[model samples]
Each structure stands twice: as structure tokens, then as C-alpha cells.
Target: MSFQQLVECATHGQTRASYVCHHLLQSGQDGSMRPVNWVRDEDEHVNAWCDECEEYLQSHGAEWNDKTEAFAKIRMICENCFETLKATNPTKELT
Candidate 1:
């Protein structure tokens, strides 16, 4: 079994920790939940974003810089919630 670190989430109780951009945590255009696109980070955390953000990333040569980081409001969520998002929303290949 893959064991991840657990932390107390006010909503999900004790759960694994995961991170994503604030955009992925919010509703997309027209208030619809959109797929979360994962960006390859280190093994310690999950870096996910929405399509627009993904596009912005690619336009910048897939590099994180001041411009990209400007709108990227990262947030922490329970792993359970992350799994829910991963299942409910369509996914894009990790880059």
C-alpha cells in the first residue's frame, strides 16, 4: 500500500495532503467544473491546473516564472478531495 503523510483537514478530517492551483479548486468558465491538468513536479506534491493555465504554461515554454506564478494561487487540499477531482474531471497528460 502506498502510504502518504496524513494531516487534519477541517472538511475531510485526517487525510493525505495534496496541492493544486486555486483555479483548479474553483469552477471553470460558465461555472462548470473542469478537468485538472497535472504538471510534473517532484514526488513530494501534486501540481495541477486548469486548461487555460496549462495553455499559459505552454506558451511560456513550460517554465515557471514571475508571469506564470502571478496568477497561480496554490492551495492545499485533502488527498481524498484530490482523488474526487481526478475521477470526476477529464484529465490531460502530465507535462
Candidate 2:
């Protein structure tokens, strides 16, 4: 699908912008990326860390870190793109 179509789908659908420490084009484990839905207050501050990060955070008493940088690195993607990435990274699952 075209980029325009992807944007439209992502915007029109409930798909929200998400952030990942690594590039979305790369493969990652399940729940590595976290979706940010502005429409939902609960989703705004929701922790989006992967299992490893979460564990580390819990261990270090730093469960909540500044997400500003991570948010800035986020690139909006549509369901199609999301699905494509999922297929590409068979071992990873989108949260």
C-alpha cells in the first residue's frame, strides 16, 4: 500500500502512535513497542517497556523514566505497516 494509504488507515483507525528504543523496521521481541493513544488518558502514561526493560526498571526502582525522547523517535504507522512488521518479525508480537 502507498504511504498515503497507510497514514489514512492509521489515522482513521484506532491505531495510535507508538515508540520503540529501536527502529520499527528492525525485529524485536513481543511488546517491545508501546502504542500511544492521545485520546485515552489511561494510555498516555502507560508504561511501554519490554519484559527486559520492565524487569530492569523494577529492579532499579526506575519503573517510570522520561519518555519524551522515546516519543520523539516514534513514527506513526498504520495497521498494514504494523502487520507487515509483525510478519517480518515472526518472533515478536505487537501489544
Q: Backbone collision count in every prediction?
A: 0, 0
* Per-prediction TM-score to the true structure, in the order listed: 0.73, 0.35
Compared with the true structure, what per-residue lDDT tens digits does model 2 show for residues 14-91?
Answer: 554333334443333453443322221243321122344444445665434554434334445554445455454423
- The worst-scoring run of ten residues by lDDT in candidate 1 lies at 38-47
- Stretches of candidate 1 exceeding 4 Å from the true structure: 1-7, 28-31
Query: Which RMSD does model 2 reach against the true structure?
Result: 9.0
Clashing pairs in 2: none
Candidate 2 segments exceeding 4 Å error: 1-6, 9-22, 26-72, 93-95
Give the local distance difference test score of model 1. 0.73
